[model samples]
Target chain A: MKHDYYPPGIKGIDGDYTAALAGNPNTGKSTVFNALTGLNQHTGNWPGKTVTQARGYYRHRGKTAVIVDLPGTYSLSANSLEEEVARDFICFAQPEVTVVMADATCLERNLNLVLQILEITPKVVVCLNLMDEAERKGLKLDVDQLADELGVPVVPTAAHIGRGIAELKDKIHSVAVSEILPRPKPVTYSQQLEEAIRQLETSLQRVYTNGISRRWIALRLLEGDHSVIEAIREYSLAEGKGAE
Target chain B: MGVDAALNLDELIEHGRELRNKLGPETEIQDEIVTSIYRRAEAIASKVAAQAGGRGRDWNKTIDDLLTSRLVGFPLMLLLLGGILWLTISGANYPSNALAALFFMLEDKLTFLFLRWQTPEWLHGLVVLGTFRCLAWVVSVMLPPMAIFFPLFTLLEDLGYLPRVAFNLDNIFKRCGAHGKQALTMAMGFGCNAAGVMAARIIDSPRERMIAILTNNFIPCNGRFPLLISMAVLFLGAGGLKYGSAIASLTVAGMVLLGIGVTFLVSYVLSSTMLKGISSSFTLELPPYRRPQVLQVLVRSVLDRTLFVLWRAVKVAAPAGALVWVLANTNIGGMSIIEHLAGYLDPAGRLIGLDGFILLAFILGLPANEIVIPTLLMSYLGAGALLELESLSAMRELLLARGWTWLTALNVMVFSVLHFPCGTTLLTIKHETGGWKWTIIAVLLTTGTAFLACLLITQVVQTLGLLF
Candidate 1:
């Protein structure tokens, strides 16, 4: 793939990939972020702890894997500062592989964020983190079953003790290189909302062809997200408004 | 209706109940929408995830319940505050005395060096005795207590108890028609009033944020810690029992509780009058308890807060010391300028149970609180004289020899707790408020409250023949 423009500062390594690590708050997301990057990104056991976005880089198989840690939030609903930043980064900045870290201890609650992101982009890896905490309470998970269910690679990780970080990075690298393809079965909301999204997507598909998913935009529109509307307008303008 | 329609309607009602439980039942439209989304998400979750080992209520929820319960919350808050104050009072005394000794010794050497260098007498006095001694006093008196208090406070913060404090106080704030997050901002104020004002930005509503900014000064800042400790020692340390320091610490902690009580009362009045608004509900997530990072918190708190506040006090104290030196040395009608000023303020001061010099010290001490005692000392023992504080007992003797009574100590304690903030805090309030109006209001309110409260206490004591 030919890159548009390299940053001014330096020479690039052969296989450098910049990834985004995102998750819901209290999901042990920072643990995974820190483990993967070999960085001590301050991990406090507190919700709303990581207010500022943090970045760290690691080299894997001659590729400089740079990861940005977005603030953990319950959803990409943009109800709070953390949500807005996380949602914007995923939609606009478009990281190569957005790794949605979820807590194995509370997988059900954590999946809401992952499912939302999957609607936006297919290039994703779900990190099942805090396996130790889950196991301590005698909870068992079939990782392959989860991966098959989500149509995305799911890696179980005890990130605090550095388990599964290597496999996670390899999976991310593979996904970024298009060696692995994700086929997410679109999560259906209520029939009313689904019909609205289908209508919006069909209308949007007639006008733009930059591979942007319209279903995501439609959900955002229904949610009354002004930023997403602005993003769509900006994208439309860049691709020539009203052009097929 | 079809089976699907019935299921959807049941789900919708279940969702409504969940929303009613989570957020309030008001704002029906928003609540309904949010509930629908959450219900859909929960339905999806149920299909894929299975609960194993019978997951109980969240530990965070349980802890929040215990900590924020009406019966336990206030007592727990007091117990923690008292414990921290006790640690600060006892931990700081030895180091404070040691620092004072070391700095005064250094001052004597510098004074001798100036004499040897053939520096002009007035210039030597201005440089060494005025500026240097003043800066020394601030660092010696203020640094130790801050070093002890900040790290301990940070430990509690790191342990995630601070949020629980906010959770506990959220109900009261809501009742008072203020944002619940005001409790978090007030906790920040316990470290520094300026930071507290900045933290008020967490509050979304302008009215509640303004209330937080205005009332931040009611909490004592780092600069006032030395005065509190010193006054506590002088008054509450009478008869010299082993637990004298403990008594002093308890007294300071009581003053802190009183400040918090006043903050709530003032915030209530303001919310009702000047800044009227309905209390907006906010989510206060009680984080899972974690073992505090002891070393990291200690280092960060000491370096970031303790030394930082100490540095500010030192900067202000240097000029203040020079000014005090000039005031003490500049003779007017056979007495120094400081003597004339003290005599002028003495009558009013006596009426409030404080003397002229104490009031004059307070006036000069506006820049930084660390130098207040040193300034008073300079006024008593001529400006050029060296302080030979041989012991804590000796230091006590000096004050007693100056005819200081329990009444004076009580007045100073009251003043320290209630006085207007130092210059830095005033400037911060101006910046935070974005105008002179609120700044002036903050100053006047705190100063007036301090004076009225002190005067009333003094009159009551005099009338009742209390030792104070």
Candidate 2:
């Protein structure tokens, strides 16, 4: 795949990185995006709050980085447009890193989106946003410990006040470049579902070498996700008759 | 798993359950694999996530629970809607009259200046009387209400109450076999029916989207509100000024509710016959409330919505004003053209519990709703040569002089609320449906519904000796 930041002819030029910014509804995903892009962004809420997507770009340490703002969805299920858009952008667009912006004031509910995204891509970062609001409610978080447990970097940010954004950018660049390793927390469904997923993932990984998480795709297949199956079929056909 | 994929999903799940049973559930390798994954994830989550203080009630969630409760939801929604309308109606009157007066005074000065310049008679009529009068009507009548309504509606939108409205009305739409998201589309209809029809594209199911498009006209568009309020004020609230505006607001809100009820009924009948399908499952997540950006909301909505509506009204109304001016001024047999037609329509109007003037108003109102009262005023006052009225109250007095009773006001209000949406909406329906058949269906449905409703209201009142 070609990267936009660096010309294709450049020698030893580090490839430009792409990151996805996702969050629960009203978790200040937009506030963070606006802060990164300096408010030179488009205006319009999602229709029926069903789906809204925005993209912003910035440079970090002389490497071009593009951040796609996925719609605020609670999970990556294909139940709503927001979820479908968010899920497709991560799996198909193949962003180098996916940042799940968690509401610090309501972390438990926000974690659902984070866990769901982590199940797809190993390159994940948890941004605990709205720290001010959390503090106002007398809550506290251990960012490093959270990072350690999830095998990913966690940053506390108050995007409205422009706090912790520099750290967020630096962490993203580092993670995307593989300078830091990510240890993702794996989730489980029912026993019967897990047995099916294990067999499905082994088959998928052996069949398509460069595709997204085989386990997540298997779970989607079980859930009757036609879009995912169509995606896999297309990928297989593109790889040629010999590859499968 | 690959073998199971070849089998039907139902049979596969059944086999999986049998395999689990034979492997003795807890001791089974499948159970251990799934449990270990969950256990590892939960352990990590537990480590970094500490109990933040003692567990206490979340006030935000509590308030949301009450606000979105099924039992209290509908009533609370109506109360808020009625309150906003009451505020707009009561607050907008003085400004609307003042604006009308100011515009008319400017028109008169322009007329004097044109005469001083010795402009040609037809040129003067077309420019000053026709073009300027239409712009003035669009500004004076449409501006104040839109200026007031859009901000209130945007405020509700920003406060995140609209999603809850969709949630609350899900059952009613489910019963109709239409998408629950139709509630959101109906809210958009209150702003503009064409926009509402456009918004219905969000419903994934074509059947439900069509149902939404077909029924969108039942909700009174912003164009019709001015007419509804005017009639309600003249008839229902005639007893006192403040009370009149309040009652007028309630009356318009009641009319809106009737439109919603009719939308559901029509959707139910259509789903059962023309478009049959089970309603798709939908889940609405309520976004957390935020403090509205007052300045941005005001500026954006005023610039975006008010201007958009006014621009359309002006474009359509100018040609209409010229046509109406010609109709009123061209004399035949000592009666101008409009009088001849109004006289012709009077008997049919009377049988339908309306007068010729009211019928003529609806006929002329087809181009744009902003001019219905102005056209009726021109007819009754013999002001065929002149273009604009000075005030709403003067117009009210003219109708009063022409034997407008409370019964007349009630019939007019009902008809205005139920009549076909404006020309733009019809064209939009045609565009969205992509067929003339559905467009014709929409036109027939709304106009037929309006005629039937007014017919019943008039008949019941007359037969009961309650109206004379």
Candidate 3:
């Protein structure tokens, strides 16, 4: 967690669990990472360019954990490099728990990302951040209600002031230990599109054993997301490759 | 079941595509996906979050207004910039002098050690006089100001004022027929031009993006910042007393203002000529200001800028020192190799109000802008490179002894501002633009501007002096 030494390569990183932090720009996603992992990330620059990946580790509850701070992005649309990275890390890197940090002030916009991330992984912990900013702005969020709606554990955190961080860590641990199963509510699509996705998911489940949600893979494939195509190839899971 | 279980991945992808196409063109599948996700988000938020009369919201609007307004904005910007520069200049003097005194004293011990060990002249000259001296100059002269300046600058950045800077400059960029995002890229240039050039990708308009890439060199990066600060302190500054720092800081601020002016002018020219295009507009998000944690600020600044300078000093300046040392020490027909090259370049250099040594140092410094001033000093002091800089005054005396007038100092600062992007930046431009042609154009454009501007200024100023 300290800057004195960053473990290099596979040898240095021996985390009992890997947790991923994802969020929109300026949502204090890094503040969450730094609070949890004590990595002094370059947490400046509005509309920040976190295109580069940064990793840090911290020990929690007698277990060493590594937190990979994904690039800040609005959604996993694979339209930009940041999106591609965030998507690939959650989908392929297969972190034990993915914490989606949402600014409490603008819960709607930030939740859009949480929904998209939910489609990809069931182990998503919604960390509602910037509670102080929201309160100062005269806004209030019902954390329990948000969790109930999303069917996940939503931890309200004023991360900058060290508020709700312990609970966030606890939620991350419980989620990582599979003690708290997050059954995220899925979005419904048009009947025709839904049928297509259903068939694609069935086909995808047979071929894609990469641990990513087959339904999310089906949707991305339907959306002509080339990045997922690249990711699928990069993991070298394509079936025809072994044949030819 | 075995053959079917294989489920050729390519075939599944093909099947997915076929199903997607079957949904028909009217479906707008991506839009539907986005909207569906957003719908779920809105549904969740409406059920959970509540908004009342947002307190302290109007205050943010009021400040942003004054900070970005036409009348009050620019003067305020200049004041903050000048104040930061002034602090860096005045604050760094004692530490720089103390470090210099400490290092030079060590250099003497090193000389005694060489004498005691009976090392050869070439060996001593290369090791102690050349490389070690250059390293000392870089650390003592360059490091302190950077340690002061970068933290201050990063503080502004961390406080989210930099985006406000982009917001203030947006109108001018639009007027220049460049993208509004070029302001952001130029702001990036203040940190590192290679980063700034890479940031040009946000422009999205090819012509405007190219303009941003080419004009990025006009904004001084942190490497050039120390050089400018030292130059201003030498000729234009009053020295490091309180008000003295103010004067020096304002001078450097003035130089930065000049560089920004050049960026706009060049952006205008490029938009009109080679990379002709209308300005593309963008919605710049101005986030509410936040107070950075004080301890975090110190740690982040030291880690980012100060450490980077030290790393660069060792990696780039060490080798530069040995090369310059060899060039200065190697005899060619009774003149050192550096002198001979300088003599050949002297005429051209003089036209631009710089001597051949200065120009040669700049050429040699193309690999790293941080080394230009050090290389110039190493060769200008001749083989000795033994000049001790206890203060700016001592350095001034050395420069004056070499026939340097205030004009030379001014031109050096200006030329440093306009010269070609560093080797890293040039490579970045090549990679970003994806061609050698645009990269070459960028180098030529920036270097040509430096020469022409320096030449014109020297001529006009000298003519005025003559008339008086």
Q: What is the clash count for each candidate, in the order shown?
A: 0, 1, 0
Position A11, candidate 2: lDDT: 22
Clashing pairs in 1: none
Model 3 lDDT tens row, B108-157: 99989999999999999889878998888888888888888888888888
Candidate ordering by TM-score (highest first): 2, 1, 3
Candidate 1: stretches off by over 4 Å:
A1-18, A24-66, A103-109, A130-142, A145-150, A157-163, A184-213, A220-227, A230-244, B1-62, B101-124, B340-356, B383-387, B400-403, B433-437, B462-468
Q: For residues B148-230, write the lDDT of model 2, one tens digit per residue.
A: 98888888898888998998899999988999999999999988898999999778888999999988989988888877877
Tens digit of per-residue lDDT, candidate 1, span B1-468:
233333433343344344334433335434444565556556555555565655532555677787889999889988988898989888988998898888878977997898899999999878987888767767777888888888889888888899889888888888888889999898888777878888887776788889988888888777777888877876676566778988998889877877888788888888899899898766665655667889999889978988877787777777888888899899988988988899899898888888899888988887766678878776776633454654455567777777788777878878877878777778988987888999998888788878887899899988999863
Residue A160 accuracy (lDDT) in model 3: 80
Q: Can you give the TM-score per candidate against the true fold?
A: 0.80, 0.85, 0.74
The second chain of candidate 2 has a TM-score of 0.86
Writing each residue's lDDT as its tens digit, candidate 3 over A1-244 gives 1211122343367788888889988898878888887752332211234256677778889988778788788878765566766887787678899999998877887888898998999999999889988887888778788888888899999998899999988999999999899998888998998999999988776674456788888888898875675666545434334435
Worst 10 residues of 2 chain A by lDDT: A2-11
Candidate 2 DockQ category? acceptable
Question: RMSD, model 1, all Cα superposed?
Answer: 7.5
Best by lDDT: 3
Task: Please compute and give the TM-score of the first chain of candidate 2 against the native first chain.
Answer: 0.84
lDDT, residue B185, candidate 1: 90
